[model samples]
Each structure stands twice: as structure tokens, then as C-alpha cells.
Target: MFTIAVDFDGTIAYHDWGKTPQFVPGALETLTLWNQQPNIQLVLNTMRSGKYLEEAIWFLETHGIKFVGYNQNPTQQKWTSSPKVYANLYIDDASLGCPVTKPDIFTPGGRPYVDWAKVDQLVSEMVLFVEPIHQD
Candidate 1:
């Protein structure tokens, strides 16, 4: 299976500290698509903790965004105990080479936000090359 680590703030949603930010354009649809793929496992990787983390989880659950793990990969615990979540791909707005749009109304003078449409396309293409993992 291919694991994908996703960021909440700025990546999936607008970066609004202390509150559930609005979903980036196409994020909901793209995430929903990824959730349906049998070969893909999603992990929520973010700096959020405590109440803020709970809020992020609530938002994702309400939106029908499914994830297999959070912060740490459940499948990796058997072999490794590293704090870093292991994923075939890490999707974060802060990462270089990730498609992003110019500053918008939501983020005045802030960094460019992720372009979900592009992300969706890229992920779709990548998924085509990955073979589904089967379990007994």
C-alpha cells in the first residue's frame, strides 16, 4: 500500500490558527477521491496538538475525509518508532515544488496557498502507476 501524509493547515484548509479553516478549492473532492482508493492510505501529519488537533479531526470526519493514521503510521510501528510519519508521498503547502496560488483574500500578505486542482491532477496520475496491495 502507498501511504500519503497530508497536512491540515494551509495544505487541506486555509491557514487559520485556533479555528477550523475553510477547505481549499477542490480539497474536499480530491480527498474524497483519495479516500476511495484501495491502495492509498492517508495519514494526517500536522503540528496541531491538543484541542486544535481534535478540531482538525472533527472537521475532516464531518467532511467525509478518511485517514488511516495520524502523526505516526500504524503500519510502521512494528519496525520503527520514529516520530516522523512514513509515507510514500508527503503533501504540504510548505513543501517546495508543490503547486500553489498567489496570495488571496483569505491570506492577505501571507504565503501562497496550495493549488488543490493541480494537486488532484498530480495525485490522480501518480495513483495510476501504483499497484494495490492485497491482504489475506
Candidate 2:
């Protein structure tokens, strides 16, 4: 299975503190599609903690985005005690080379956010490259 770590704020939703912000356009659809893939396991990776983290979890659940792990991969603890979450891929607004939309009215604090359309396209291309080859 391939593990994918995804950030919450700024990546999935607008970067707003103390309150849940609107989901980035196409974020739900893209994540939902990934969640349905049998070979893909998603983990929520973010800086949020305490009640804030709970809120994010609630938001995802309410939106029907089911994930396998949170912050740390449950399967990783068996092999190592590292604090960092391990994944074949990571989707975060802060990640370099990640497509992001320019600051707009929807963005909080005037900060740019993830561009889901570009992200989806890029991920689709990556999947095509890694898909298993079949022979007759």
C-alpha cells in the first residue's frame, strides 16, 4: 500500500485559526477519490494539536473524508520510534513545488493556498508512471 500524508490547513481548507474555514476548491473531491483507492492510505499531517486538531478531524469526518492515520502512521510504530510521519507522498501547502493559488478573497491572512486542480493533475500523472505493467 502507498501512504499519503496530507496537511489540513492551507492545504485542504483555508488557513484560519479558531474556526473552520472553507475547503479549498476540489479538495474534498480529490481527497475522497484518493480515500477510495485500495492501495492508498491517507494520514492527516499537520501542525494542529489539542482542540484545534480535534476540530480539523471533525471537519474531515463531517465532509466524509475518511483517513487511516493521524499525524503518525500507526503501522510505523512497530518498526521505528521516529516522530516524523512516513508516507510515499506528502501534500502540503508549505511543500516546495506544490502548486498554490495566488492570494485571493477566499484566502485567509492573504496567504496563498494549494491549487487542487494542478495538484490533481500532477498526482494523476505520477500514478500513471507508477502503475503496474500488465502483459498478456
Candidate 3:
């Protein structure tokens, strides 16, 4: 089985910085197709919180996305939401911060960084589906 952690904002939706969010072209359709597969699970990872997050959930549900979980804080316990499904891909558009790695730049303290580019690349290459094994 393949689990995917897809970011809601810029990744599947067009994020205009301070402007209202918009779904990227083909995002919902792509998601709908992905959901039909038995082994693919789509999870939402975003920064939105509280009521805003609920609103997002409603939106997804309305669009026929029935199997999705939101992790507002990707680095915390929320990661436990879907512990059984090990994610092979995580898609987001921050270009700076990603949960899988250190921040891209040092905080005045000078530590390693999270390279969002690397995360994007890794997710892009992940295989979302595999052929089922057939018994002889």
C-alpha cells in the first residue's frame, strides 16, 4: 500500500501568499482518481488551524474526498493520525519548510535546515500504485 501526504495549499491548491486560496488545475480530479485505487491513501498536511481547518475539510468532503486526514502540526503527535500507513510521498509548496528535513536556513542560532526542494523531489518520485500479486 502507498500512502501520500499532500499539502493542501500551494501543492494541490494555488496559494497566493496573503490572498484567498484556490484549487490548482486538475487537483481535485487527480485526487479523485487516486482515491479509486485500493492501496492509495491521501492525507492533508497544512498550516491552517481551528475553524479554518474544518472549513477545508468540508471543502474536500464536498468534492468527494472521503479518506483524508489533516495534520495541522506536521511535526507533532498529529503525525500519529495515520501511524499504520507509512507515507512514501509528501507534497507541499512552501519551498522552505518541510517536516521531513531541517529548515533551509539557520535560525540565528546556526543549525542545519529543512530543504523543501528535497521534499518536493522525493514526493514527486514516489510510486503511488503497484500491481497486485496474482496466485498461480
Which predicted model would earn the best lDDT? 2
lDDT by residue (tens digit), candidate 3, 73-121 = 2333554764433455666555445533332342222223233344434
Cα lDDT, all candidates: 0.81, 0.83, 0.56
Candidate 2 lDDT by residue in tens digits, 27-64? 99888888777878899999989888888898899999
Task: List where candidate 2 sits over 4 angstroms from the true fold.
Answer: 129-136
The C-alpha stretches of model 3 lying farther than 4 A from their native spots are: 16-21, 72-86, 95-125, 128-136
The model with the greater lDDT, 1 or 3, is 1
Which is superior by TM-score, 1 or 2? 2
Return the clash pairs for model 1, or none: none
Q: So what's the TM-score on candidate 1?
A: 0.87
Q: Model 3's lDDT to the true fold?
A: 0.56
Q: What's the TM for model 3?
A: 0.58
User: Positional deviation of 67 in candidate 1, in angstroms?
Assistant: 0.8
How far does residue 26 in candidate 1 sit from its true spot (Å)?
Answer: 0.9
